[model samples]
Target: MDMIVQSLRLGEIEIPEEKLIYMERPVLGFEDYKQFCLIEIDEFKPFLWLQSTEKPAVAFLVVNPKIFVSDYKIEINSKEIAELDIENVNSVETYVVVTLSDKIENMTINLQGPILINTENQRGKQLVLVNSDYEVNYKFMTHTVEEETEVNREVPVEV
Candidate 1:
């Protein structure tokens, strides 16, 4: 089954129907749109576009939080699990929305609200972690500016 989506970046593209993820509840701030497709691009490895099926121009950049935060974890209660029709916990795929900035250094990830998808059922939900250590603006990269350098050259030093 071929599905067509008016992608924000790639104009129109054909995707498989099974590839579309159905959200039991709308993602935060996007209440009207529930169906979305995860589009992968070679240039954006480890990051994919969550394109809304209802709104062609609506899309989000999402990435697996575990990639950067190795200890990242979200505890979903039985209610949420059952809501997504998730039979196996291991089958859940987690992703966090990425916020890009004019300065690459200011790029951040919304760790507090992570999207959990049940691959088995293609159902998903954006969950807000209660009492989580994560932050909404978790910087993708941290840099420290050195007042003085050996060559006296101003370079953004990554910490």
Candidate 2:
């Protein structure tokens, strides 16, 4: 029999698949982290925070590329894409790492470094875009949210 559950609670609240957010592997400085979940702290706001499930000591704030950097673009390596078993680019969801500052105006999002993953397949990869004209910590925050979603950050690109 095939049994399906809508949402699972990591601590207390139940997180549904529709609310689950995925992240890729972290860069050299954050190599240890692999799995993460995006939790929505607000309903009106577009900003979401990433929390590491693999190590439990890692987390980052992320945002939609269209919100802050108007001309931000990222192209990942084919090998890394293959490793994640990504059959097509459409299967992947992209999110940039963010840094929150004391003042809301000082926020930034890491456009250069991005987290890529296949939400359906449950695999992910943190790739560095060689030609990306962005930073490791791109902050773009005008306000903050208290809740977000979480999902597996890494998935095998190939069998």
Candidate 3:
């Protein structure tokens, strides 16, 4: 089934019902809205829009920590994931909210709180890692764009 969603950023769009994610436990400070959809924009490849279907204006920039921090790992309590009805661990995917700053390098991601979703059932919850050493504001973009682009340009030439 296709549901029409009105988004302030993306405008009105139709998406499959399966794409809708119902929050088992709503996002922090966003309890009123439990339904959201992860929208991926081509220009913003690594980043995604965690947009609230209930409220068009509510959206957050999110990304997988593994993209920048390859060794990013977190331990979640079994009870915390019970609501997601996880029959398989492989169905679970994690995303962290990104905070943008005036400068690109100063951008940060909330590693202490990660939003975990079960792809099978389309249910999700935001977990606060109480005992973890992760910070809420961890610097995400450390390298300059010029440095990465230059390296990419040299890669194909060398190959």
Candidate 4:
């Protein structure tokens, strides 16, 4: 089924259309949050807020693994893919949960657990990186959320 993209809100944050990062699975504890859009309150940085149309109140702060542990990889099972009806890997969007800090730049992402979604079908899943050496919070220093938003506006983020 072709899932329609809808606007979402989290707390006082408004997740824009330009911030969406599609994935292959509609994550657990979030079966309702299928089609999610990602927003970076700070750009060139590692922290972002996730908002799904299915559950507007549901928003998560996430980061990229590349920012922290340079060599992090997540192993997904075939059964999980089949469950989400995922065919192409490109359709999946991955986001690591983030735990904020007093110093925004010091914020860390949860690499040990990652949220994956199939944008094509609006399916999502939050899987544990049990076999990998990843942390719940991986810290990094980069641009502000506003900066990232500006860049995304200039150039569309693909897949």
Candidate 5:
């Protein structure tokens, strides 16, 4: 059965009951909200909203880390897999929360911790990587400032 949910990001929308995810370990700083739904809109191709059903005003921008880092991978311990009731690795989906910067060029994603969900059971958990070089604030968009070198500087020549 489909249920109507009010989202601040998308306004009132109807979501299927199967699409509802129950978080075993809710997102950091949002422990009170265990029920959430992932909303994807075409306009925001690379980003999706993890809207909290409990609180319509609360939503998170999340994306698959692989979208930015094609080689992104994580090892899930047996404990985590069992907790999520993940039968097979293929049933798991990973999403990282995106932190938007005032300047779009500076936007970054949290790779150190990722939200893993089991599609079969609709259960999710956020895992914090303990033995990894993944940065908490990994910048996906590469931006650099041009340097002013002496050789390139304009020199005034005597007439």
Candidate 6:
């Protein structure tokens, strides 16, 4: 199952065919792409690239919502669950699209729209959560290391 893909980050690389995830419904803004591969870079653990197979330049940075918000949850309709052929809830894998910025602290995660995948069937769908408390610009990192360190060093002056 050796397949080569022209990736924006890795140039041309070989990937396993089975690793490709089929998107039944296009991701919100990326309706043109129907197939994508989840590439994991060791340097960026808990973060991965959802690279489109149809278009090399199209890619997205995604992460598990639970990493930052432990209570993150998604409720999908039965029709969607049936479309993915998902039987057990454990078979589904969820991820939120992340928008990175020059300033790490300003990075945001799209919680309202989550990409749900049926690992067993290799099928995926980007679902919009209805009436969710989550936001599109949920600050992923509220404080930088320097800021945290500076706060820790602060000492109250004598009253």
Candidate 1: regions farther than 4 A off: 143-159
Better of 1 and 4 by TM-score: 1
After superposition, the stretches of candidate 2 with alpha carbons farther than 4 Å from their true spots are: 1-13, 16-24, 136-159
Which residue pairs clash in candidate 1?
Answer: none
> By summed lDDT, which 10 consecutive residues of candidate 5 come out lowest?
150-159
Runs off by more than 4 Å, candidate 4: 1-36, 39-47, 52-57, 142-159
* lDDT against the true structure, each candidate: 0.80, 0.57, 0.80, 0.59, 0.81, 0.80
- Model 6 misplaced stretches (Cα beyond 4 Å): 143-159
lDDT for predicted candidate 5 compared with the true structure:
0.81
TM-score of 1: 0.87
Per residue, candidate 3 scores C-alpha lDDT tens digits across 42-142 of 99977899999999998889987766655567666667657888877767788889999999888999988888888899999998878878779888677
Tell me each candidate's RMSD, in Å, in order: 9.2, 8.0, 7.2, 7.1, 13.4, 9.8
- Model 4, range 24-119, lDDT digits (tens) per residue? 445556665556666565453456666765665677776655445444556677777786677887766666787668987887677767777666
Write candidate 1's Cα lDDT for 40-72 as tens digits. 999996789999988988899998776666667
Candidate 4 least-lDDT 10 residues: 150-159
TM-score of each: 0.87, 0.66, 0.87, 0.59, 0.87, 0.87
Name the lDDT value of residue 152 in candidate 3: 22
lDDT of the structure predicted as candidate 3: 0.80
Error of 3 at 94 (Å): 0.5
How far residue 120's Cα lies from its native spot in candidate 4, in Å, is 2.1
What RMSD does model 1 have? 9.2
Quantify how close model 2 is to the true structure by its C-alpha RMSD in Å.
8.0
10 residues in a row with least lDDT, candidate 2: 1-10
